[model samples]
Target: MKFASTGLTALLLASVAVPASAETLRWARAGDALTLDPHAQNEGPTHTLNHQIYEPLVLRDEEGTLVPALATDWHVSEDNPNVWVFELREGVTFHDGAEFTADDVVFSLNRAMTEDSDMKELLSSVKEVRAADTYRVEIETEGPNPIMPANLTNMFIMDQEWAEANDAVEVQDYEGGEDTYAASNANGTGAYRLVSREADVRTVLEQNEEYWGADQFPMDVTRIEYTPIQNPATRVAALLSGEVDFIQDVPVQDLGRVSQAQGLEVETAPQNRTIFFGLNVGADDLQTDNIEGENPLANRQVREAMNLAINRDAIRQVVMRDQSIPAGVIAPPFVNGWTEELDQISTDVDRAKALMEEAGYGDGFSIQLDCPNDRYVNDEAICQAAVGMLAQIGITVNLDTKPKAQHFPLITGFTGDETDFYLVGWGVPTFDSAYIFDYLVHSRDEEYGSWNATGYSNPELDAKIEGLASETDLEARNQAIAEIWEVVQDETMYLPLHHQVLNWGMTDNIDVPVDPEDQPKFKRFALN
Candidate 1:
């Protein structure tokens, strides 16, 4: 229950706020990372913080390009199409001074694929990782994965020796509340080293003088002071008052105020993420619903009614302040399966009511909606809008708002589909549709569907989703992706709200562009 209350969380974070100096950057965001164990959580804020302290085999730069970090180059082996060969970067060292080698790569990848690892879905195609030599490693997959490199951008490499020494080889069971050395401390071969950490309050980091990328990238930021301010006004005030130099999430309502302020500037871009509501379609009976013997969400008519009830245009204009792109599909336009036609949305209260009546729920039914207050841009506002909209279709929504730390776990199934309906945002780091299918659309087999709380499972669809890993034929793979999208849309699996728009508020003296994924690499920041 850390950071359980917004007012208290904001006060605690504000008390620890530090001033920015020429060699230091004070960064503020809406939420703090759930844990420091890099592979434990696949979340935006967590990955943003971890990216500074952990070195991935490959990383998406400020320009969103797949660039090398630990691995110098990687390609499929000529001997075996299912095998990928990676050449490790030489002369690299972790924060604790452990030498980077192929053994670390092999060990880290194996660890990330464990059951407790939230990042296992990205490596689901892999069969094994083997160290071929001092600086060479081989990853054998179940089939020929054409986009394996794309998936490794966030697969952080941990120092195997350091992990073993600290007894942190296993991924921290984040949802289970298991605290280990790795969760509170970190040792990685990245640009910054963890100086101090206080969950949901303050985290201090210092630049690694011995970082291998020192000469390669800008490496301008020498020290960092990151604070999570849950309140939107407080976050904006920190940037305005010069207590913080940069804020990753600039509230849409405050974008103009921040931009017009004396020394502040706002940079915006279309984020590669979509916000949506997930229904527990697989459940026979919903725990929160007032109705008995059956789950309204399980019925396609009810699901369709809920989907049709959402007025994306209204939410965009009012709740989002026109800072969103209305989406009819969960996959953003940046993803492979997205189509202009599929991104189109329509709303009809009469139609939705008719569908609800056809499903035999003519009067109404009440269900609880678990939403994150600090996760996305105006997340609670969007959920609040949904409440009134869904009521038109005879579904009374009792809204429950929590911090991202508590809210995300509910959708991730730590308690096994703990809530009937919830709000979640997804960004495709791979820019591939398979990433969505593997995690959000796949059956909740505990391995494939880490975020698929819907419980809707189709063996045939699952086979197609799994086949996407090794399918080398480009056209065939794309066709299969289209087919999968068609099924998802037809099933009315989710109520997709809209694609997010990112607005970063920072001091005018800071030089950094808005990252499409909203994950800014501080090493790229330059002081004007």
Candidate 2:
């Protein structure tokens, strides 16, 4: 059992000089990629760093538009409706001069389906990945999968031979703290090649001259020096001092100051993510609460009361500095199944107190809330604000803030079900409700719910979530989504906070639009 942690895991590094050449883009973010192993973790920052050095069959442009990458074209086979046939791009080679072929696609996709791969859940519907020809591959799904392309945007492919040679065939066991060669090294068909890495300290990348899209893209940024500055003030100072060219997240409070500074710009966009708190309502007894042999969160009345106690507008105004949209549902507007009615939420303190009394917890109960300090914008502050709000409904919250690297495993099940209450930010790369249901709302099992920290489980709900992947009719699929969401909302397993708004701060010379998913492809960067 994980207790409340007062300390944070720090990544200490010495001050280093940042090259400010027009061809070099100095980048800084609040957190670092967990690993260089592409399939190890399905995280935004990790994928952002990996995208610079790796290529996926399908990629999302800065505007979140699906574009061809390794696969020149893809479509469901006319004869086999359940199979997705992909025409591989020719004349492509890995960084080590290995030819890219269908064999690599078959090997990599199967590798990603391994137990250790966090990308496995995304491919749960996939039956088999086989090579039809030298440059052609086919992915046979359990049924007709309409959203196959949407899921491939971030499913990076790797060189099978390289993995075998480096003994990195297995995805790195990140949660178990197992390290492998791939954890720190990479070779891909992407526009840039990894030069050096120092975990959370700093990393360097140089443009790949032989990259297939070298001529197709701007390729203006020849080198990328990435640094993760956990402290917001230090990160902002880095940008102000000309030490960094761009920052993925600009603190909301410093947006005006940074945008007004000489030769700087701040671009804003609604992120395709939701910030929320998870409750372990399935457990019989409270893990880290004041009351023993009783889980206050298990009671529906208590959960409803907790939800009512939360003031989303206050968090949006105070914690987010009016940068976030108060959310009623976990799904953002960009998702397919989102509706304003389902996203409408209200707060009533008196109603919450009455609900608590109805649940037989008229006085109060104390529980620990696990949160990440550097992962989300004002993450700790949001938890801090909620701690005070929850107190009004007689729920005493002990907030424990730590670096994401340490905090994520608490809910990820890579370690254990170590947390009863936690904060998590969910980004829908597929922009579908099924993606959310499969990962967050479904019951924890081999095929789904890898991120659902709450112990809540229902066999009927699990069947509905599974049906989404194979549902062919658009009208029927959407209705099923609505029904699933209704169940999720009524349970109140998660307390929705607000939809995050992204702010990318950069120098005026950079010409890159804000990606709602927060993954910036440097190859798309055009430096003036």
lDDT of each: 0.89, 0.89
| lDDT tens digits by residue: candidate 1, 245-312 | 98989999998999999878999999999999998888888899999888888889999999989999
Which residue runs does candidate 2 get wrong by more than 4 Å? 1-19, 414-417
Residue pairs of candidate 2 with colliding backbone atoms: none
Error of 1 at 178 (Å): 0.7
Q: Which digits, one per residue and each the tens of the lDDT, describe model 2 over residues 1-528?
A: 111121121212224535488999989999899999999999999999999999889987777788899999999999999999999999999988999999998988898889888888889999999999999999999999999989988888899999999999999999888999999999988999999998877899999889998878899999999988888877887888777889999999999999999999999999999999999988888678999888889999999998999999999888889999999899999999999998998999999999999999999999999999989999999999999999998889999999999998888872234999999999999989999988898888777888988988999999998999999999999999999999999999999989999999999988987888999999999998
Best by TM-score: 1
TM-score of decoy 2: 0.96
Query: Where does candidate 1 stray beyond 4 Å?
Result: 1-19, 414-417
